[model samples]
Target chain A: MNALDLDRQLCFALYSASRAMTASYKDLLAELGITYPQYLVMLVLWEEGSNDEGVTVKRLGERLQLDSGTLSPLLSRLESLSFVTRHRSAEDSRRVLVRATAEGAAAKERAECVPARIGERTNLDPASMPELLETLRALTRNLRAEPAPVESPDPPAAPLNSHRASALTARH
Target chain B: MNALDLDRQLCFALYSASRAMTASYKDLLAELGITYPQYLVMLVLWEEGSNDEGVTVKRLGERLQLDSGTLSPLLSRLESLSFVTRHRSAEDSRRVLVRATAEGAAAKERAECVPARIGERTNLDPASMPELLETLRALTRNLRAEPAPVESPDPPAAPLNSHRASALTARH
Candidate 1:
């Protein structure tokens, strides 16, 4: 009942599963010569097919919950791969829009079967997917909506490994 | 319901939630001067508290599902921070053992409240935490257990964008 049992923490579970999910995409993504995150950007752009204005970089970041620091480099790589193109929006010089290149858009059809392959790998019930998705969304929303909880002010805190370990697993 | 719809993909959902969970840990982890992944390593070591014979690098890799390329640099950083020490095992020179320094072990007490803080942030019912953990574990297990599925060879497939877009949302 150790409080920090790696298996018991939701954070570890999420982290582990997320990494595993990424790993699962390795070979699949390789087919399209894009990394998983790159594929995600393409997904958004492909969904917006033929929107000449494409998606604003800001909108892409918002959709993916990525900051420009991360998104900018990723977009650049996608651009280098010819999977996507980024241009300053005509109406807003300050804004950049990301659209899939012909090559990138063509990858989508090949990508269509990607999810089904992943679905089979997870062995998750399609019927249950909706509920699972909802739970994850709720988890994300709740985590994002709140501030980090405050720690108690106390002297007996540090080095309580053995002592506090009892309390960590005691409740959960 | 575009298969490429960012909102609809389970992979994106997991990716977003995982990143959010990591973000939620920012302040909490900053207090410990460790990154999210580094904290995870500490969690494992702390759980093995006072074991003179600490965990092997191989075992740590297995436990964390991280390769040596990633784990080695991380361990080096932790060692440099004086939070951990690594040495070659007696019986197996090839096997390295990692143990926490007094500083790292003591940090565990302060970290005890971390999970509780995160749990509060998730706002998940304590009663249902176990189920969520199980689902995540199952997902990781399944994703890791399989090889990537094979794609069929057919020229009719490459440009199924507009044609297949109809089916992606239709099913899901």
Candidate 2:
């Protein structure tokens, strides 16, 4: 198989694996009433202490690599669920601060089991996990340092060329 | 310093990198009027010749690890763009087949440059590329092997736990 073959490409493998990991989380998160992204947001809040000034949407976007469009709606959903609250920064009106409520803080206890569950799902040995993290971080760093080559002509468009005849057969 | 550190997690690294890669693609894909997921769907169809009945939504979702909710909307958007068509199978009404249009096939000529562009963005030397890919593939594989643990309810969800806080600091 060629290097660019879907199965051969590490990017595809990582991409597929990531998708699968997210899928695995679907059921677990469903009970929490949140999607993967939402769960990630919640995770961030849980770690940081939701009652604090909270994290900013911009900061959240930076960490998550999501833009305002995705993050805004997601935050709204969390707010509606009462998992978080959106507050305007006193110093910077342009910035939004997201703090967790009592209920949100309470949710943390429910989420404690999540990491272990995820660990089990991945079946990743604790020892090798660090190396794997390093590799992914390196790749992500490299990708982020480079500029995007293609620009969309339209604003917020969809996919272009697609066919049904071929399926992405996994080639080892 | 600890394994539980968010920065130390291969999953978070992979997740972050994937989001970064896709975010970078937004401008490029938008210029082409396609989203990142749409581009992937196109990759499967275009590379496969989109000439056959196209790919089934279920098959596409299975390979992509996406459910019907995500796939249905994405396919519908593709259909609106005239890139693909979605129809029910005569034998199985529950099944939906996606086929590309002539225009969709032609779009490939324009997109042939995507891989190279994305590769350049990664800044990985040709020699390092394979190793990087292999490591990511391994990590991703490990993550997909087992069922992820579910979220357990107990104490309230904390936005930032001590472990995660330290991890975040370490990440910076």
Candidate 3:
């Protein structure tokens, strides 16, 4: 296959599959009255166990790989929907904490069925699903691995083609 | 594995991998002076062959799975960058045609090397890459499969819980 072929690009395949997966979640989540991102937030909170102190905003952002600019608004929307509540942590007033609300927690019972439904929609063999997950996990790990810092002795105003490529490719 | 566990959910895996893939493309595409989405547009245009009559906006949307609302601004940005040119098709004025400019065509040579570089970053065995690609393609195909029209005899203002789940699960 040609390297530039859209159909052959693994990046495009991931992009398309990710979007399709999210789209498939739409109607399922609509019943629960939360968007997919909100559902993700709920997942984190639900995983936290009910008695634990809520997660700090920074922690949630780190977990989701989303910056505050994106997460702030999403957290706000989830708050408005009564799916989550936010408060300043007692230990650090500067830090905000987020946790799923009672309504949000109740929604989980319904939400539990979502993954299996989405799984059935994918029509993937149960045996092969773990392999697919492992591949995607490995890909993400490699992509997120930090590039070794470039030690440019004579800093150019702009990165040259070789510099840019090296910066992108240096990560294992 | 718990279906809702953040680390275990295949959707989360896909979502993270997709975002990470785009992040890795940032520096490579920055050298080309295009964002990742813009780079995707260029890929489609490049694949149309140098002399094709260009692609219609609607056709481009269908190809990219983006709606006019999203593609309009993206196409406009590409035009402003002089990488692409758009005009009303002569045969059908209602439809717009978009084609790569000479400058855009020139970028393809540079872009050709990107996939291999990304492949290196992924660190997956080249022999196993095709299987991964096939898996992602199958996942996307199954997710996008349209649900059969529901023949609901009882008309209800809101879909019941079971109805919603059936609507989502019936696609496969």
Candidate 4:
């Protein structure tokens, strides 16, 4: 098999499996009027247990490993649905804090069935879950620990066009 | 810890790791002017080895676990980049075939470094990779094997609203 065979790549395995997991959650999450990513936010708020202080956008970003650019739009959608409310911190106006609303908290009850439903559907062995979780977590941790790439001083060259195509194609 | 803790969910772990993997591929793929998903398609095409009769769109969709709705736009983007060409099959006008252009095949050279780059970035142990792949593949298999949800005749009820909110919150 080619070393670059798509099936042989760990990244491909993770990518395919991840999308499969998300697709499995789609209909169930639709019933709760949320997407999979939105469900994740609710889980965080639910875990915080109705705290008035809530979580800062920065903290949520840190937890989710997403930047403001991505998180802002998602948070806005949740706010528009009235599932979440965001307000400037009283003590620090510059900081925005997010909390689950009554509706959001109530949504949790519907969500509680999700894990069991997924479990039944996938028939994933419960005994294997802890180990699987640990492996995935380690992978994420290692990937995240990499140093950021240094910016290239030069602009990227134009994509290879047809002139060199025949030679390149011949080699493959 | 709450059973529903965001950090505790297997789906979240997979989702987070998947995004982390994609992010790791970004700079490298940018150099080749392709997105991660697009790169996956190329990998499949490259594996098929420059045959004149390329894979059909239906076959591509099955291999990628993506429906045509998603694949159509992605294929268009790859076509625009001159990496792949799509044409109606002469045998069946309805069937569209996708093949890597010479440029696409050449890209494999640059892509050869990707797995190693990702390996170094993640610092993933080579010994652990096979077991990890097996676990993830099983997860995907089980998830995809699930029966599609039965459509509910009735529209979902409005969010639980305030009446049920306090009870749900208290229980948590």
- The DockQ values of the predictions, listed in order, are 0.34, 0.23, 0.34, 0.28
TM-score of each: 0.85, 0.70, 0.85, 0.83
lDDT of 2 by residue, B1-172 (tens): 2333456555577688777677666666776688878877777776563457767887777666678899888989999999988888888888887887887777777776666766666654454454445545554555555442434444222222122112211221
Worst 10 residues of 2 chain A by lDDT: A161-170
Please give the distance, in angstroms, between residue B120's alpha carbon in candidate 4 and its true position after superposition.
Answer: 2.8
List the RMSD of every prediction in angstroms.
10.3, 11.0, 9.4, 13.6
RMSD of 4: 13.6
**Per-residue lDDT over B1-172 for candidate 3, one digit per residue giving the tens place of the 0 to 100 score:** 5778998889999999999999989888888999999999999899884676998889778878999999999999999999999999899899999999999999999999889878866766564555567667777877777432244454233221221122211222
Candidate 2 deviant stretches above 4 angstroms: A1-4, A30-33, A49-51, A148-172, B1-4, B30-32, B49-54, B85-97, B128-145, B148-172
Off-target runs (Cα >4 Å) in candidate 3 are A146-172, B148-172
Cα distance off (Å), candidate 3, residue A159:
27
For candidate 4, write residues B59-163 as lDDT tens digits.
Answer: 888777888999999999999999999999999999999998889989999899888878766655465566567667766776777544575554223221121
lDDT of 3: 0.79
True contacts kept of each: 0.75, 0.43, 0.71, 0.67
For candidate 2, the docking band is acceptable
DockQ, computed on Cα atoms, for candidate 2:
0.23
